[model samples]
Target: MKERRHFIRIVYQAPAQLSQSGAQWSATLKDISLHGILLSCPDGWQPGDDPEFQVDIVLPETDVHLTMTAELVAYDPQSLRMKIVNIDIDSISHLRRLIELNIGDDALLHRELEHLADLAEDE
Candidate 1:
């Protein structure tokens, strides 16, 4: 199948947490992009009727933690895919820099930032 992703995915594993309905679970980060994230499914997590999640990823060897609210997009037995729906300015800045360093293309990163901004404007 042809690739359908618009954002470049960077593989950066980190410890993460997911929260929903006042409960929290530990999860392992698989990868991330400007638009979404892939994480190992939290133990005992069931989709059911809940689709929104609060996520926090703590970068390894750093004091940085990127937090965002994401909507469940898809999932399988091993992983959960989420689309970033909301993020604060500070978290987004940190995530942007993280992506920039991993992506290694200033122009491409800038274009993606513009697209992200446009998406926010449309919402």
Candidate 2:
């Protein structure tokens, strides 16, 4: 398939937690973008006919965290692709700053933010 991704993905590894239906698992944060996240699937993950999940990613040694409600868009034996559906204000701010620091291009980051805003407006 043609690459249809509009957001720039940042490869950032961190510790994360995923929970649903009272089951929680520890996962490794693989990569992140404004629209989604990719995580190394936790062991014993039994998707169990449900694709919705809540995630909490903590920056290794700091208080910063990114939390969101996500839908399991796809998954493989090694990883899970989740589309972020909702995020709190604080998490979004932290996420934007993290992306800004890693993205390294001011104009490109601005354009991506604008694109994200346009998407939000359409929703």
Candidate 3:
């Protein structure tokens, strides 16, 4: 099996109501991909349990806010890190532009653009 690559960074506040037990916490995203994100939170969370939460990502070097629904896919108690999955495309697009701009690299952006172009060509 081949390993997959991710193309985004997580940077935002943790969702308001994530648990029924009133365990509210905040986290900062370390990296993000279209599929999921790696976040570091103050409290420890468990994997396999779905946590209903929202994430706010400010576009790098800008104030554009991108918010979306995220589910906890995996967790590490020692590291206090978790993997959030099921990010939407709209949020991905917005963050992609910001990453391209702030990072000053168009590789990923170009790849996405080309993918869109290919889809358009097919249509």
User: How many clashing residue pairs appear in each of the predictions shown?
Assistant: 0, 0, 1
Report the number of the highest-TM-score candidate. 2
Off by over 4 Å in 2: none
- Cα TM-score of candidate 1: 0.94
Per-residue accuracy of model 1 over 25-53 as CA lDDT, tens digit each: 89999999999999999889888688999
lDDT by residue (tens digit), candidate 3, 1-123: 875444344344332223324455555556654445566754655443446556665544665556666766556753233344444677667766655665666786677556645755775
| Candidate 2 residue-wise lDDT, 44-108, digit = tens | 99776788899999998899989999999998889999999999999999999999999889899
In angstroms, the error of model 2 at 78 is 0.3
Off by over 4 Å in 1: none
Q: C-alpha displacement of 48 in model 2, angstroms?
A: 2.4
lDDT of each: 0.93, 0.94, 0.53
TM-score of 2: 0.96
Q: Pick out the ten consecutive residues of candidate 3 with the lowest summed lDDT.
A: 12-21
Error of 3 at 3 (Å): 1.8
Identify the candidate with maximal lDDT: 2
